[model samples]
Target: MGALHLMPGTTFSNAEELGDYDPKRHASLTLRELERYIALEVVGSCHQSIHSGLGRPPIAVWREDEGEIPLRLPQDRMRFWLTFLPEEERTLRPDGIHLFGLRYWSPALSADVGRSKRRLLVKYDPRDMSRVFVRRPSGNFVEARYADVTLPSVTLREAQTARRTLLEKGRREVDMRSIIRTAMAQRELVEVAAKKTAAARHAKARGSKSKVDDGGWGSLRGVDSSKPVPFVEDAN
Candidate 1:
């Protein structure tokens, strides 16, 4: 499992502004619930904007624009589309200047069954600023609009990136262990071959010495037979 920390001050926009709302009254919803709501809302909106023949409408008012609207405080938990604008382009337009599509406010904790973690996932199209997707655990999906007013202190991207990094690190660790095991097996094979060679050499030396002793005994028996034959003739 992985975790991400959402910092405050992340902002997003949508086709229409969501009216004012309070989070204190609805404290009954758990943190996971809130996260799910944001994810579903953002992803749905992005998909609609891109694929629903909407001609890529402007989702949110850019922050840098002169007439950009300020998001109301104590926001409602409504879904909205988000996009990133290059610094150069941000200064050009007010309402229709977002670069990457799909943005959403995420909570601190949520269940991500896909990755087995409570993390947020954001998918956006840089080419089409209208198509964006956000995923969370709430089971609530919002498309092409702002979520019900909810103060979001975290950005979805940060959470997703952190989770990815942790998973990659874990994989590297597993690979290292496998390499060590393979090296150890190779070393054991070398030791076994050396022991077998030493035993064969010792056996060959012993066999040679036994053959020499047998040959010496045979020579001695032949020489003694000559003396035995002379004693037999004298008796006859």
Candidate 2:
């Protein structure tokens, strides 16, 4: 990522520019920023670069090849998209399918539990690990969600991060439940901390709230301004 490259107008650029090292910067960049950076490379600078062997820009070559290439589209778009998703071969047990320390279950998968001996092809979306698509022997995909329906959806990165954090905290084995619990706890703590920070900032901005002067003698209390009568010294 630290590799140096020449830009269209700039003298040079470091790929590591995408990495934020400033302490003031957030822990992670937003997905939109990441996607934009990827798009910039995939369809912008990289495609515009001239290919040495082809004697033309990659984008020009792609445009020329587009007309000659046959576009074969699948009848089922869902399956087509599923084919591109990350896949893993998992055994479907009577209880359900276990993946990434999470359990997934679908009523359709129950009947095939004892009947099939082959491992089923499972595909999941990294954006939402709450559900997965399992390919059946009949060539149809069965959808399954979390075994614990109450569990909130989590991203693959979040799940991995939680696992690592738990490990660092001396957890022997981290599971999906523990990951969810940690996420929930972190969210609550963040909310509380944010409120406290905001309140403190507000108070600081307004300065001390303790009242000092009563704004001239017009606002002074009667008792506070009252003078004591002169003491009489008549032998007593």
Candidate 3:
């Protein structure tokens, strides 16, 4: 047994040392060639030729115990894989389950009027948003179809990205509105100040004009033209 182990182990390790072990060359091999090489030249030869301590060829022993291997159907495998997908807690809204702005509903969900606003675990595929699976109270996943099928296809990734982009745009619009309001308020203040300054200047000009008009009367205060009786002549 030790002699047999030494030979096979040395052969496998030496295969990598050979020039045929180039990864690029190996990758270029077709699937048929690869499979044939693996099945015939690799462990397949060992399984068929080598005998274990049980005194039977490794492949024969494996064949005898084939029933011990678990056989899973395609649907069962899918179910098993889906069970591990990440789930989100969502509520059933009036329109249906809203995920990334898209609504999803099913006949089962629509039939239950009392389920509105109820929380459920939802699992969806990023590659396909046309349908989602909701974990029902019975601990089973129920398929939910998109409410509007006429629309373009939307993946979960696209939905999330669009939602984020819209959110950012909304926030930007809010900030712009705030800035516009502040600018408007500042403009109003400036306009009010300008009006007040203009009014003050006008009032001052009016007062100065009135004083100038009254000064003309002051020049006539000493003049008494009605009692003038003598003529005055210039004497050198």
Q: Using lDDT as the measure, which candidate wins? A: 2
Give the residue spans of candidate 1 off by over 4 A.
1-174, 209-236
lDDT of 2: 0.71
TM-score of each: 0.16, 0.53, 0.41
Computed on alpha carbons, the lDDT of every model, listed in order, comes to 0.34, 0.71, 0.57
lDDT of 2 by residue, 1-236 (tens): 21112211122244374333232221222455656756666666556768788888887897899889988878889988887899999999898998877889999987888888999999999988899999887878999999998999877777777777898999988877998777667757766876776677456646957332223111223333367534232242
Q: Which stretches of candidate 3 lie over 4 Å from their true place?
A: 1-78, 115-118, 171-236
Model 3 gets an lDDT of 0.57
Cα error, candidate 1, residue 85 (Å): 52
Better of 1 and 2 by lDDT: 2
Q: Where's the lowest-lDDT run of ten residues in candidate 3?
A: 2-11
- Model 2: weakest 10-residue lDDT segment is 2-11
Off by over 4 Å in 2: 1-29, 32-73, 173-175, 186-236
Steric clashes per prediction: 25, 0, 0
Q: What is the lDDT of residue 75 in candidate 3?
A: 67
Over 78-193, each residue of candidate 3 has an lDDT whose tens digit, in order, gives 57877777778888766667665667888777655464446888888766677888776556777887776554455555555555555666753332223333434554675687
